[model samples]
Target: MDTDLSLHASAPSPPTSPPGPKGLPVLGSLLDMGSDILGFFPKCAERYGDVVAFRLGSWPAVLLNHPDDVEHVFVDAHEDFIKNRFFWRQVTAIFGKGLLTNEGEDWLRHRRIAAPAFATRRVNDYADTMVQLTSEMLDTWTPGEVRNAHADMMSLTLRIAAKTLFDASVEADVAAMDNALNDITREITARFSRPFVIPDRVPLPGHVRYNRALRRIETIVTRIIAERQRHPGDRGDLLSALMRAHYDDGRPLSDKQLRDEAVTMLLAGHETTALALSWTVHLLSQHPSVDERLSAEVHRIIGKRRPVFEDLAELTYTGQIIIEAMRLYPPAWLIGREAVKDCEIGGYHLPSGTTIFVSPWIMHRDPRFFDDPLSFRPGRWTPEFTRQLPRFAYMPFGGGPRICIGKAFALMEASLILAAMVQRFRFQWGGDRPIKPSASITLRPKGGVPVRLHERENS
Candidate 1:
């Protein structure tokens, strides 16, 4: 998105407008973006350097690709940047005023309440459930049958999310919840990147489907919330944590607030991790040597035992594998924010209301930071290399004060699931289907990661 620093408070000298592609007429870069979002931004960054200017219809915006700039926006001046007002307005229908969309006091309160539930010790409690649920899912897969890894991962993660977050067994609700979520995400993503923001109330076919999906999800969420409230004790679930928490004034989270946070966790907890696992499986299938190394690593660490919480620390290569896959196909691909006040990002002055985009999609592949940026090399993450790498250069969970609170939990979940699955099966690329990355709300495999399952040789 282009910026005119003239509107903001004056600097001692005139701000130099950053160089960018001369977009076509009034439509700007919308047409190019429609064709390939992942390619478009990276091309701009490659051509124009780190900070690139463009337009999403009429809204002025800029893409910041430097790690230092990323640090400035998300860390140094986080208060001056909040969730993009334009984009968040579209998702509030589904996300509500939960931590995903809320700001200031409400966000702080919700974060405070939800924080304890995801504490390292507490998150460790869910490992048994994650492994058990994954094992149960694997029970149904037949050797030599080709299954969509993404679809299976979605189902497995949703079940894990339901059980771990709300302490409710949702074996029956998985299919319905997944279908509903697909519809909702399709419609919201269509709206989010459109030439202009379309109001949700409009009577488009997708809008109808989106609303129906929302209602289906609400019914399921409402059921979970009601069930939790009835058995409202310390169940070691997120809902219990929120219920046990009180506001500064001693009031508890309302049912509405609880529902909002529950849905947020439900979507985030499952979807992103599922994508990460799905992509990891895809990577493993394509890179047989990497797959062999990971298989050996998991076998060496876990070796015929169902994984336990204590085993996580030993899964070093397994952790690196997940991190590398995310670097390539980050589920949360782009981070969008709006400047609430005039701020200098990467030495350029951006005015209030300017849409600022930080895409991990572009950053992860920048040659300046990652060597042979597109290669899938897990070994690049040596402790010395990680320490020497720029802090914001490798932020899959984002950075600074408002970073994803679920970082530890998500990484642990992914490592556990990957280690368990890799140890038991060898995935062969199902040749019939092409798996392409879909940069929707979360980056997902467009056609699903199709792989022929081959159960391993030893126990």
Candidate 2:
């Protein structure tokens, strides 16, 4: 594949780089990025055209707002671009060389080993566990009870992730895992945004807390791997599949590799899915009519029984609601890539090593692709609407070879959890305060989403 923009094959010469806002000397647009991470791209795109060039600290960068350009980076010439070193450097300490952060052949090998665990059949087998865990959590809630919807979803998903992936009971480690994950995510987000932040090796206040949290996580993962090795039995879980896998060269994964992959799955598997569900509930609360439609669909398809894998295909409206919610508030909001060789994107000349930013949050809401882009309308995701849209317009799970490995697992898990909860309870706005989005490792509800739950009379 040519590094130049294949979408514009007829262009006579490479186009000049896109226009961007001026920034401070040395610091460039780093402060703007640090100040409002979520708002930054749209602001730039509104001022500049589809493609914008700027800097993050001393690094040369471009932001691609159009779906065609996004497709180029994520799919057309994927090999010419690699994961942004600066962005991944922040969490590589925690994730190591796991599939989420690894690159090249190493990434391929890890992906190959982990792929079977997420196959349609295997993911389908885990559907019952998702509904069972969600039911258990819902049982603890009372009608008219006020709850932080974000926290509730997080706790529920974490439990589901643990049980489904590791075949471990939630009682032993869910609390500690939750605390550690919070601290690690907070610290990583802080370091990633600020260009002038101190190095992790230096013992800053945040670094100290981050290290402590990391150690707790390391302890938990190490113990799990150790116990699994001693038993060496098939538990019908992801961990078992990974343990039993071997490379083409007849080599098994080392203990360190096992730990890294396990931690990556646990973090990525639960965190983003939980956030997606939380945002879905928040959107439903504000749009009661949409909620009614969604509830009615769930009732008609699932009735009072727990959701099953086969019911997913029949719950068309329920799927559309989740799709629309993610379009508005994608958990993995921004994707970054670095040009390994000079390239032209949307006719812009990008030099080697240029950092490129693609935001699903911005693109999904682009008025060009979506009608009334800001409105919360699940009905917009009809078959004709989706079929006619650009492929890159709705990428909550990303795209290409490096797209999220857990995409199927997450969609299934979210659908089941949403279906189960909606059938039993109806949520209402619990407070007068408006909730804002916080762009951290994942897009999260600022503070938390406070909502009142009313149990259904029939349920």
Candidate 3:
């Protein structure tokens, strides 16, 4: 009820705009934002209260830092807000009109078609594949050998996503796919930070790289679709399910629809989860006690055996660690939505076309909702703590109708993979290099986390 700014209710004078820092003329905080995107929100909130207004170039924007305000945008008045134009343009450029980018009935239809593939039963079935893939990756590691945990994770999860979703082996194409994904993410991020006038069609260096990446991705997806078409059957994977799916009117998705959905799953389904695992490993390396407890739990539960789907429920502490890691460094750190109609939120009058920003990175660490918010304490995720907390306070995968469709899958995948890896190897920071979090399409370690692997003797 904190944001119950109903227009019909009796009001006390006209509502004033939220307070924020005044920046340089025209550019308007753009330089500061680009300098440290991750730190910008908390700085604004600390200085100007939770609901702070700012400008992205000349466009007016507001950062909703409180969980209740986040709830209003994501759940209560969600219908009035749609994906922000700036962010969606970049996402749609790569993902096309898939579930992640589509809106309205198209979104609903696509959601329905894709929903079955990620059902509880289906995701549980994928747990074996998750463990299998993680174990395969671990087999290549040697004690005292340094590795880029982020790259290793990206490669591992990409393969799992490919096999589980498409019943295809992307091992041969992993390098190509990884390079393309990196190019696209880098290009889009660059576009996001700069002024908005530059079109993707223009022959900017980044744009050219982005288009090339797009072609590479299209080639991969197109090849997969063509093969599936040639010899179609229920392969018991997402692509097969999508191919078999039919609308209420008995029509099927077009080849383009299939391609878009496939590529969306390929990009989103792997990258975010891999980043989560990488950060978890980094955090675990720093916190030895937490790591010890996690190892103990994994050994006690699975003990020299691969984790099964049912083991996920009993791996409660492992789940807590992943949850806490995401809380500290959520892969999807920021959520952007634009007002479709003039609306009031947190007592501020936001006109139509206003860009609304909600950041999990800031809200997750807000002292109001979390005790010892800056500390990395997996024990803090008790049932009582979660029950009392606002739902939006910890949206690592987002919230409401558009909440990540792969929530269950990501959790299960992360938990299973964490259990599998931690049971076999102990990771330590390879050197004194400080790993910085980069706020791009997903939160990633700036250079990549370098870690030395110490094989567990008992295992």
Number of clashes recorded per candidate: 3, 0, 0
For model 3, how does the per-residue alpha-carbon lDDT over 1-459 read when each residue is reduced to its tens digit? 545757457857867899998977887888888888888889999998889998887778899988889888899989998988867877676788988888988899889888889988888889888888888899999988999999999999999999999988888899999999889888877766765757778999988999999999999989988998999999888898889988889999989899999999998999989999999999988998998999999999999988899898899999999999999999999899999988888888888888999998999999999989989999998999899998888999999899999999998999999999988999898857788998888898988989999988668
Instruction: Return the TM-score for candidate 2, rounded to 2 decimals.
Output: 0.95
TM-scores for every candidate against the unseen true structure: 0.95, 0.95, 0.96
Which residue pairs clash in candidate 3? none
Return the top candidate by lDDT: 3
RMSD of each: 4.9, 4.6, 4.0
For candidate 2, give the lDDT of residue 450. Answer: 89
- What is the alpha-carbon lDDT for the whole of candidate 1? 0.86
lDDT at 117 for candidate 1?
A: 89
Q: Report the C-alpha displacement of residue 294, candidate 1, in angstroms.
A: 1.3
* Full ranking by TM-score: 3, 2, 1
Off by over 4 Å in 3: 1-11
lDDT digits (tens) for residues 1-459 of candidate 1:
135655675657756666787677777777888678888888898898888888777777899989998898888888888898756776788889888889987798789889998898899999999999988988898999999999999999899998888888888888898899889878876775577767768989999999999999889999988887777799898888988888888888888988899899998888889999999999999999998888888888889888877888888899999999999999999988999887776667777788988899888887888999999999999999898888888878888878898888889889888888887899999967567787768898888888999988754
What Cα-based lDDT does every candidate model obtain?
Answer: 0.86, 0.88, 0.89
